[model samples]
Every structure is written in structure tokens, then in C-alpha cells.
Target: MAQKAPWKTNRRKLDITPLLVTNHCPDNIWPGISTQSGTGPGQNGFQLKPGETKNQTVSEDWQGRVWGRTNCSFNHDGTASASGQGKACLSGDCNGALNCRVGGDVPVSLAEFTLDAGDGHTYYDISLVDGYNVPMAIVLQPLENITLDDIPPNLTNPSCQGTDGLLAPQGYNPYPEYPDFLRTNTSYPLPFDQDVDENKISRWCPWDLQQTPPEKPGDGVYPYPDDNIQRPQFNPCYSACAKNNQPQDCCTGKYNSPSACKPSEYSKNVKSVCPDAYSFAFDDQTSTFIIPSGAGFEVVFCPGARSTTILSTSRAEMLQLSQQGKVDKQATIGLKRASASKLRRNAASTTFRLDRTLLTVTVVLTVVASVHVFC
Candidate 1:
């Protein structure tokens, strides 16, 4: 038997469409794009500040993902700064490069896209398959003179926010003995039942699997003032595969087939939290969404649940503001938060809530307010 060669990049010319990426988080973020197939936007990534937007063009038949990197510090040339050493962001660091050529590190919230996959349509999804770091959403631009009569309701716009924006608030630890599952031939039994409490399923990345952030000031890492919280300090939540690497957790060896591999307790919990987002590798049926081709996309980071007004606005209007140098002004004026009651209205009773102390920390962090060019 001959060995199969690796898939090579195809550099042929491709039709392009506009892509607008915005940062709605109070803090700064570095968005990363890694193309798996077809032509990319040209560069792989760049930095996006709060309330700011970047305009780029992506190939029509592109297959790739977009994710935000948090708590990063880089030199002017885009290399990792001294404080970051060889790594930049605490979550989705890509060898400390401003432009990433590969997918980000685990615990990244990804918006995956496959444009023009079939019948002049695009298939997309928000994936927590690699774990999650931030909230994200994708809205398609309305096509001129074309009605989307055939698009599915779920495909109109896929978003993961509200409780999904949080990272492991429950702090559920499946492993009584840390790193026990990492041993060869050892398997960590699934901790929760399929119908387990919504709050019991951790992201599968207990405190042991969290990525440590640089403690140095100006490194962009945000630490909670009170150390009393039981959750992990850093944001990035590593997947079970990342932490254990066992065949069962990684879907390797005999577990490579879909039948052999199933959702772990961690992924099950994630699915309950964000049904529209991918919880595991084989979570395609419910997680994926489809829309027609010829539509542009708007990817927003930290798109809070209270910001429905901004989200409801058309992509064209937002892009026009970005081009006209009025995005910042509009964001400052039209992006005000709704009432606190309204914000918490849809929250599940079992969902983790930040206490007054954490709320104060968040307020202080917001006061300290502060990327990828694919074209």
C-alpha cells in the first residue's frame, strides 16, 4: 500500500466576497484566520480593538475558521514580545505571530465556514470542538435583489452568547486525581450522565488543563482580583483530548470511527450550553448551518446578549460606518447596554451567575479598555 500525500494548498484565482470582523468586547483582541482550502484573504490575521472593525475579502469557495486570540502582546513587527516569550495570547496563540498560518491553540471559540459547498450555498458553524475562550457570532449580509426564501431559520445567523460566553463557571472537575487519564492505556470514565444537570458538565478542561497566562503587567492578561473563585484563573479551557491525549478522548486508534467515538461528559455539557455550536468532533448534524452563496459575513467577538440593537443592524450599514470612519462614534452612541433585567431575562435558572464581587471586577476590567487581514 502506498502512503497518501498531504493535501497541498491550491493557489488558483477564486471569486471573492466581503468579510467584516468587529470587536465588541470591552478589551482588545487579536482575530486569527487559518485557511484549510481554497484561496485565503492574503494575510492570515491582525489586531482588532474594541468598537473597531476590519474589512477584508475572502474567497468564495474558502474553507477555513476565524477565532479571537485574547491577552496577547506583540512587537511592532508582529513577533511575540519579551513578556510573551515565544507565545503571545493566553488562549489562541499562533507561535506569537500577528498573522497566523495555522489554526489557533485549543480552547478557542471558532466560526468555521465552507463557502459554496453545494447548491450555491455555504455551510458554517460555531465550534467548541476544540474548547472555547470567547463569545462569537456570524451574520450574513443581505443580498441585493435576492430573497433568501430557501435558507433555513437556524442558518440566518448563528451566535453563541449569554451563558455560553462564560468559561467553566461551574468549575466541575471530573478527575479526582489530576493527569490520571493521561497515562497510557488508562481511561477516565465519563463523570456525568447524558441527562446530567446542565451545570455539571465542565468544558472538559478542568483547572489542570487551563493555559497559564503571563503575570507580567501589560501582557494583556486579565486576572480576577479575588482569588476565592474555584474556577481556573485563565480563560482558555483545554479540551479533553488536549489534556489526556488518550485514544478514547482524542478519537484515535480504535476510536477513530464515528461509531467508536461519542461525546464526552465535557462536550455534552457544552452542547447543553450552546446547542448551535459544535460540542465534539462528530457533532455535525445539529451544529452546522447553511446559507446561500453571494452573501457577505460579519463576525463579531463578545457580541453580548444585550447588544441586539447593534446585531440587528444590517452588515452594509456597519461596513459603511467602518469605511466612513464612523464606527467608533456609532458604537459609542448606539451600542449602549440594555437594562440589567433585560440582559438576564433569558438566562437559565441553573446557569452560573457572577456575584456582586465578580461584577465589580468586570466593571474595573472594562474601565481598562483597550486582526486578521485575510485579503
Candidate 2:
């Protein structure tokens, strides 16, 4: 048998859409403590500070962004489809007092043989929805040959690590043997050589450090006047499970939640210990590829305002073109112009005449021929 040329295989194009949203709010302020130790001079022997009566309202903005991608393949027989979706989210206060929460989800769908064009080309269509309440969406289309090697790897376990961990490496300096030490340090594992060609698969899970109980005043040096020696330190296991909304190990021997484990301290380490996971092709599997698909929308939020500006762009021109009558003429024209430029630059060596009449006639004939061949 003769070797086949790579270009001779069927070509496929993937389409994707993603959405994004953002919101902002102000910060909060609390009253300061009084410096006077004993009762102050007043009618009742304790006087209230002049300015302490009022409660100050600190304003803050909470901003969030969400997006998803979809992909589809084009069949020479006129039908085009593929399947892929990705989602990401970010939330935080504009004043920087509060920590940000980020998360991502990738959902995949597959379509079996739906259309067949014997011209060495098969068609698949994939669509994605962010499904979140935020005002954001994105679409992407990736073109490829129909060969099995052209399929991109799936992205699973997507995640986001907020800036809260900036102090983790230093603040949580326990030895590796400690469970909390492992939780803080065991970020997704990387290959020792950091080379894709390596065959080993590396993985890491978050662990928790064991909190040491505070020392009693009599057991150590004289405690400070304000020190609370008996104050309990938190237990790592109970703290972690609680913050995640998981079943608390409080009663179970396997996972115990002692009085020492404060919910506040437990919540502080959640994002740090739970970084996102990303899988990549090892060097040996470099033949793999990743194509993103989706329609994208940009929702910009102004300072101190709750409303935002929403703008949508094309993920695949075909999808946008299919919706021509539904969208504004200006949007359609812009998409058409952009699509024409992209096709000219990226399409295989074949030349497509774009003169209005000629292009319409050509497209009509191609569609008719495709229908007959597939039927």
C-alpha cells in the first residue's frame, strides 16, 4: 500500500462559545478598641467616645468573570459540527481586603457519525454554554484534518488559585512529614525533568498541617498581660472539610474536628491548599493539540456601579453567519469581513472567489452537490 498524504485526509473545524461577567462592591470598616484601661470620667463613671457612637459603612465592589468555549468540525458535504466546552470564574473585592475565588469547569460532548461525505471528510458540531448567572460568553473554532491524530486532548480538573497563597509558602513552613505541610506544598506535581517527553505522570493532592496547641503560661516564659495561653489552635482536618462544605469529620475517628480548629482559620487555607489541576501532554505525546471553540462576550463593570457593558464577538464565522438575519447588520458585516480575512489567511491553498454573484452561485452549487453526495 502507498503512504497517504496528510492533506488528503478529511478536514474538520470546531466551534466554541464562552461568556464572562464582572461585579464590584466596597469594603467594610469596624470600630476601633478604646485605649483606656479602667472606666473613663462620666456621669456613670464610664464615658462613651464622641465619635464612637456611629457605625461606619465601608463600601466594596464584588467583581466576577465567567466564560465558556465550544468547537465544531466542518463536513465538505455542507454540515459542520464538533463538541467541546470550558468555563472559568473569578470573584473579588475591588478594595483588595477580601480574597478572590476562582473556578473552572470543562465539559465535553461527542457526536457519532451523523453525516458522511466520501471525500475523506467527516463533520461534527460542538457547542458550549457557561450556564452561570454572569453576563459572559465566548466561542472558538479549530480546524483540523479528519485523521484520528487531529483530535485534541480533553482538559479536565480545571481550577483557579487566588493570591491568598502568596504567604502560604512562608507562613506554613512545616516539615513535609506533616499533613498540613503536604497540603500547602503539594501543588499539582510536575515531572522532575519538566519535559513532556518524559513518560511519568505526576499528580498531587492538598494536605493539612497539624496545629500545635498553644503553650500554657506556667509551662513556658511569663505570658504577656493580654495573652490567652489556653486559647486553642485549630485542627487541620476539621477545618479543611468544613470550609469545602464536605461532611465534617468531627464525630468520626478518621477525621476529628477539635475545639482548637476555628472556622475562620480553616477557611483561610481553602484556596491555598486547593489549587486547580491542569493536565498536559508529556513530551513523548507532543503530537496532541488543543483547539478552543466558543462565542465570547465582554461585560465590563464600571467603578462603584452595579450595571456593566456587554459586547459579543464571533467564535466561528459560520455560526455567526448562520444567524445573519437575527443579528444587527453592522455586526454581520464586521463578522463577514473578519471571516473573509481569516479564510484567506488560513484556508488551504484553494482559492475561493468572493465576487458577490459568483460567490453566491458557487456556494449554491457546492451545497447542492454536497446534498446529493451525502444523500
Best model number under lDDT: 1
Q: Write the per-residue lDDT of candidate 2 for residues 236-257, one digit (tens) a residue.
A: 1223332244333222343344
Error of 2 at 46 (Å): 45
Show where candidate 2 strays beyond 4 Å. 1-17, 20-91, 95-157, 160-290, 293-375
107 in model 1: Cα distance from truth in Å? Answer: 2.1
Q: Which ten residues in a row have the lowest lDDT in candidate 2?
A: 302-311
lDDT of each: 0.55, 0.20
lDDT of 1 by residue, 57-80 (tens): 877778888999887888878866
* Residue pairs with clashing backbones, model 1: 41-374, 41-375, 45-371, 45-372, 46-371, 46-372, 47-371
lDDT for residue 13 in candidate 1, whole number 0-100: 34
Question: What's the alpha carbon RMSD for model 1?
Answer: 15.5
